[model samples]
Target: MAHIIMIHGSWSGGWMWDRVIPILTAAGHSAEAPTLLGADPGGSRFPSRPLTAWADQIAARVREAKGPVVLVGQSRGGLVISEVAERVPERVGYLVYAGAFLLPDGASLGGTIQSAHPGAEPIFSVDTATGMTTVLPEALERIYSKTPVRWIEYARAMQCLEPLAAITTPISVSDERFGSVPRAYIEATEDQVMPLSLQRAMQARLPCNPVFAIESDHVLPSSAPEELARHLVEIANRVDHPARLRRPVL
Candidate 1:
């Protein structure tokens, strides 16, 4: 069974995957959802950290796993997984991007989002003093567009400020390393935070095999946990890790 590492994006913590993890475990796959350095509720207690720190945190997990593990990144966590694969490719069995930023080398999340929604008002307001970016509580409406009211409220309560430095940090990956690892994508079709057009654009550019689409918003954990869990398991079932690859059996 594949051990799935679930990385949360901006303003979110490991708690985001609480609903999804149990289902994954029930299906006989182990899962981990880690809160980024500055994305936890007590995140503000510490100073803002850099992208390498986040990538380092995950790479350690990959190295410590019993075998090569699947890296499943959601939202900005995609970059972290990509960086991890680049650094320790052999330790990574598969890479899965869920409603995430699948940017090429040298692309920063902030720049891509800015470029995508050109001339639009900023979704996050920056705290120049602390290098933190916070979403207006109201913006949860757009980010979790299709989610129920209770989930949104939970998200609002759990969400914290994200580090500006992390989003602005451009990733460095190479074909020989990061590219060698097998990868897939899970598209959140109705995402307002990262629009469907942008999702398709990234898929076209990067081109992951066996792209899976979900009719949900950006926050799939809250909106479509079971569906997301199913797709993840299906993707995990396909990769054999350093051995011959096997196509998913139905």
Candidate 2:
């Protein structure tokens, strides 16, 4: 069994993975879902941190986990996992990107998102003075298109403002570090937030083995929890033999 470290996207906390965590535990894998700095609405106020520092928080968890460690990131959390793998590649057994921004080294999430949809209206409203950002209400429908209405209300109530610095910070990784780790991608096929074409482009730029696809929107955890958990368990089952194929394929 592997210890899975689940990282949530912007405006979301560790609680975002609540739907999928129990299934992973029932499958015999342990899971740790941590809220990134400055993203917890109900917790103590925290100073905004750069993307790398956010990654360091997860890396610290990896150091404490026993057995194999699998790092999974959703949406903006993808950048967090990338940097963690760079800092502690030997400890991380695998990396999973679930409807996430699997950016290449030196890319920032803000830049990638803008480039992905040129001339498109902004999806977020940034408060420059406070250095925080919140999703525009009109864009909510696209983000949670496949999510059930029952969960959508609760999710929006819990959603919090995310730090802008984390989105604008660029990441740097070495081949000997993050590149040495085995990785996989869980494509949300119908994702409008990070559309399928953009997902494919990222995988092409930074290839990972055993690409798996799911027919869900951006928030797969809430919309397709069972399927998400099943894929995660499948990855856990292959922990011992995950690195044999480095090229991503169906």
Candidate 3:
């Protein structure tokens, strides 16, 4: 069984993966989604927390696991996992980017987004005084277009403010470490938040083997949890027991 660690993106907590965890566990794989620092709504808001702290949190969890782990990052969580893999490359078996930011060294989330879609900022309100960024309820439909309306309503109620530092901070990764690990990318075809064009551009820069695509929006874990779990499982299996092509015997 593979140890799967799921990291959520900006403006989201570990609870985002609630639907996918059970499916993975039932399939005989151990999965855990830990809330990243500065992400929990009820917890303290440490706006000064750097991106490294976020990555360190995940690396710590990976060290606590019994064996090597398959790290899956969604959206901004991709940046966190990339740093985690850099820190503990030996402990990670596979790196999966589920429609996430596959950035290179010295790239900040904000910088990358702006580069891809100029003048495009997060669909949220930032309180400069408090250093907290909040999502408006009305924008839920735009953020999660493919999700059920009922689920969107539920998410709107549970959503919390995200730290501005986490999104603006630039991450550093090395080719010898983060780039050496096996990786896969799952593309959300109908993603409104991160357009399919940008998703393809990011993946092209940091290519993944056996890339998979799903006809869902940005909130894939909630909208298409089963399909997401299936792709993850497939990647895990391929990593664990790679298929071999046999040569014909004359």
The root-mean-square deviation over C-alpha atoms between each candidate and the true structure, in angstroms, is: 3.0, 2.1, 4.2
lDDT of 1 by residue, 1-250 (tens): 7888999888888998999999988988888898776666654453445578888888988888774488988898899899998999888878899999988899999899889888765668898887778888668888889998999999888868777887888889988888887778899999988998998888777878778999999988889999999998877676534464432211
User: Which residue runs of candidate 1 sit more than 4 Å off their true CA positions?
Assistant: 44-49, 240-250
Residues 199-231, candidate 3, lDDT per residue (tens digit)? Answer: 899877787776899998987898899999999
lDDT of each: 0.83, 0.86, 0.84
Runs in model 2 lying further than 4 Å from the true structure: 240-250
Off by over 4 Å in 3: 242-250
Candidate 2: residue 42 lDDT (0-100): 66
Candidate 2: Cα lDDT at 156 = 81
Q: What would the per-residue lDDT of candidate 2 be over residues 42-98, giving only the tens digit for each residue?
A: 665556565866888889999999988989999998998989999998898889999
Residue-pair clash count for candidate 3: 0
